[model samples]
Target: MSRVFDAMMEGLRGNLLRMGGRAEAILDKALRALWERDARLAQEVADDDVEIDRLEVAIDEGVLKALALQAPVAEDLREVLAVKMIATDLERVGDLARNIAKSAARSAANPPIPFPAALTSLARSSQRVLRRSLDAFSRTDAELARAVLAEDDAIDRAQDEVVESMLRALERQPTAASQEVDMIMVAKHLERVGDHATNIAEDVILVAEARNIKHAAKLARNR
Candidate 1:
């Protein structure tokens, strides 16, 4: 590869990593806002999502241009595809974080209730998974990526518990139904965050070994 092309690829990687960090930050802020019932912080998280969206579009455009100009093949093609997938996942993570922030803002504007314990646990786990997956991608560590995949099940279980708790809360205190509903949405958003993180981890596998683990088994016996 030419120096310019190499620099372009490196720039893309750096931007993607920055995007991941921003997404994580947004999620963390949203969670803090939810915990503290801080409407301003929630709105800040939502507003910050615009930058992540811009980064996603710029990364995709760069990838398309590089593909056309460089005509990457074999491992290079896999890397390009993986970066595209990782960017998409990070963008979605940002969207989900925005959603949580919106929910938190709504809740903050309303009653004086607290966030659910189960949901809070789930959100923290989901955030950890998101960061862990990004760490795996930065290090190109497939084993750590696989560990992130394993964390998704715990999030799912926590989500189910949160849903049941919200439903019961709705039954007992119909007046605070909106708050209960917010809890449900937050749980769902966090669950989806975990899902997106898992997706990024799968993409990391592809980037590390040019193996598509989503379709094949343990990246085609490379486990």
Candidate 2:
């Protein structure tokens, strides 16, 4: 029975990794479409979202089956629950990437505006956060997952700067409001990607350390 349970866990982990890899790739493609102003690539990103959705459903079903058959306890239970949470985060990341792709397509239709430096930094930072979070999960590295959490604040700041700069641009060139607004939406989507990555990192910490850090800050403040 233990052997069967172990095999089941391994299979679930493999599926989660495959899903994460696909989500990461789709995110990269979406960003490339935005940067390169490729409507075709943007459309591809939207079309690829269905794959992530399918994986999420599969992971959910696997989790239910594992719970019913294995009745995982303690760390095993934590691992199972964390995998489900991580899959949900990855699914949201895919959705946000599709939103960015839509913004990219819209921006491509209009005359190109100078991409804000802050927006560029936000995009890069968010992508790095997401990649690092996924890596931490793959290795079950609590330290790396904590580091990913630390980086989330900087991504948030970068996003704010991007928004402020875009607003200023809006003020200066009212005629370009549509492009600026699209850029603002793109920045927002990227920030949300960072948020989802942070959630994944938190789940990694849960599985690695048996700690639930979600809402820890708020809980501490209330205390």
| Whole-model lDDT values for every prediction | 0.89, 0.91
**Best by the lDDT measure:** 2
lDDT of 2 by residue, 77-137 (tens): 9999999999998999999999999988998899999999998889889889889999999
Q: How does residue 131 of candidate 2 score in lDDT?
A: 91
Residue 69 of model 1 has an lDDT of 94
Number of clashing pairs per prediction, in order: 0, 0
Report the CA-based lDDT of candidate 1 relative to the real structure.
0.89
Model 2 spans > 4 angstroms off: none
Put down candidate 1 lDDT per residue, 70-126, tens digits, no spaces.
988877777778889999989999989889999889888888665568887998899
Relative to the true structure, candidate 2 reaches a TM of 0.98
